[model samples]
Target chain A: MTPFDFFILSGLLFAVGLFGVIVRRNVISLFFSLELLLNSANVLLVAFSRLHGNLFGEVFVFFVLAVAAAEAAVGLAIVVALYRYRKSVNTEDFSTLRW
Target chain B: MREVFFYLFAFLSVVFAVVSVTHRNVIKGGLSLLASFVALGAVYFTAGAEFIGIVQVIVYGGAIVVLYLFTLMTMDLKNFGKEPLRTISLAAGGAISLFLLFSILYAGYRFYGGSIPATVSGAKELALPLFYRFLLPFEVVSVLLLVATVGAVAVGRREE
Candidate 1:
């Protein structure tokens, strides 16, 4: 497949991820969407690395993976804590901080 | 052959993502999301990013999705009552995302006319950059993962 094809695929994945983040009310689903968005970006980075015949973009993808794992760990912890205290995982239920 | 795999995996990823977001059962949603991630990894493979495709399948499909599923198992699924399916909000999201997708496709079509180069770098090529150039970030990420693990344990620990 061409790099252009990869770019288009990643772009669609990112758009779907964005839609999920905007429309999903559940925090966990939101997190899943966020990961999808990150992966889409990773896809593009790898494609560019290949297109330019450079390894820099691939290196960046490694760092991104690390950060994503960390984010997932911490984010899930926060969600679990919120669920414990509120007994609900809906975004609206945890909107006490909204002004 | 390559283009065929690309289209196949891309279609699967998009379809599963739609199902993931729309499914009412959170566990099923997480599983569908896992399928989407695996399909995306296939897309990466078709693009000649071998290492990335492997990492995507292992980290995203294996670890992250499993983590989400474990978290989902801890919750009461039946408690997720009637979701507020806002018509206006759904329309707005669909419109914005469709516009974004079209814009990206247009830009890609305009900018990427030449054939992609035939050089395909494997895992060995990625190792040098990971260990040498981006070494500090790599180490820092390890630290970040450690902290996240400890923090998760501390937060999830029950009061005695």
Candidate 2:
């Protein structure tokens, strides 16, 4: 496959993830979108690494994976805490800090 | 052969990702996300990133999605309430993402003809650079993971 094919896949994934991030009100679904966004980046990174004939991009994917995991863990924790305080997962209800 | 599999998996991943994004039920959305991630891993495998592909499935499909599912169990889903479809945000999100998609395609257009070289990046092939050249960053990531774990526990813990 050509690099452009990978670009198409990555771009579509990013767009879909961005749509989800904007439209979805649920925090968990937001996280799902966030994961998609990260995955899209990973796809491009792997493709570029392959194109360059080096292992650096693949190695960097590991770091991205680790950061994604950490973000998921910490973000989920914050969501849970917010849910406990507010009794809702909908973003509109999270207006306590609103000016 | 590889190109066929790459296109197939790429199609599957994008389809599942769209489903994950649009589905109303959070649990179902997460499950579709899992499928999307696995399909993406297959795409990686087709691209010859075997180790990254396997790790993608194990980490994203197995760990992250499951963690989201568990967190869902803690919330009252019945009270999630009706999400009013505002025309403004829908238009905005659609417009922005469409623009971004086109921009990305345009950016990658110059790279159209090049094909990825034939090289299998399995764990063994990847370890040399990962362990030797990028060793410091690897250690930093480990530390970051540890700190994240502790922070998650601290934030999620119940009060005394």
Candidate 3:
């Protein structure tokens, strides 16, 4: 497959994630979409790393993975805490201070 | 053979990503997301990034998804009622995403840069620069993970 093919794959994934972020109401599903976005970026990064003949992009993916793990942990923690207070995971229920 | 597998796994990843995001059930979405991640890992493998692919499966497919599942288990899924789809928002999302997809593809098509060499980079090849040049970032990521762990525990802790 060509590097351009890789771009297509990554772009489509990013679009799907973007659509999900805009459309999904559940907090968990939104998180799922966010992961999709990150994964897509990883895909493109790996592809470019391949194109450039270096390991830098692969190494960057490692950092991205690290950040994703941390984000998931903290984000889920916040989700659980929010659930405790709101009893709902819907985005609409999250508007406590809308002016 | 490599190209075939790449296309296959890439197609699977994208399909499963769509399914995972658009599924009506959150659990199903999560499961599909796991599948999508695995497929993406296979894509990486096809590209000869063995270490990153393995790490993808281990960390993303294994650790992160499980963490999400457990966290989800703690919540009352029955309480997360369905949200009605807004036509206007759906249209907007579709339009915006189409614009992004088209622009990205156009840019990629226009790219005439250098192609990748045949050499596949493994963990060993990656370690040299990672330890020497990128050492600070490596150390900082560990610290970031540590801080995140503590923050999660603190934030998710039940009040007395």
What TM-score do all the candidates reach, one by one? 0.94, 0.98, 0.97
Give a tens-digit lDDT track for model 3, residues A6-90: 8899999999999999998888999999999999899989988888777789889999999999999999999999999989999
From the highest DockQ down, the ranking of the candidates is 2, 3, 1
Residue pairs with backbone atoms closer than 3 Å in model 2 (clashes):
none
lDDT of 2 by residue, B1-160 (tens): 9999999999999999999999988889989999999999999999999999999999998999999998888788998877888888899899999999999999999998978887898989999999999999999999999999999999999878
B15-59: candidate 3 lDDT, tens digit per residue = 999999889988888999999999999999888888999999999
Please provide, for model 1 over B1-160, each residue's C-alpha lDDT reduced to its tens digit, 9 standing for 90 to 100.
7778889999999889888877877888899999998998887788778888899899988898899898888999888776788998899889998898888787777546665565666789888888888889888888888998999899888778
Task: Using lDDT as the measure, name the better of candidate 1 and candidate 2.
Answer: 2
> Which runs of model 3 end up more than 4 angstroms from their true locations?
B112-116
Error of 3 at B9 (Å): 0.5
Candidate 3 reference-contact recovery: 0.79
Model 1 TM-score, 2 decimals: 0.94
Q: What iRMS does model 2 reach?
A: 0.7
Which residue pairs in candidate 3 collide? none
The DockQ values of the predictions, listed in order, are 0.70, 0.90, 0.77
Tell me the TM-score of model 3: 0.97
- Among these predictions, the greatest TM-score belongs to 2
Error of 2 at A26 (Å): 0.9
Cα-based lDDT at residue B146, candidate 1: 93
Off by over 4 Å in 1: none
What's candidate 1's i-RMS value?
1.5
Fraction of native A-B contacts kept, per candidate: 0.63, 0.88, 0.79
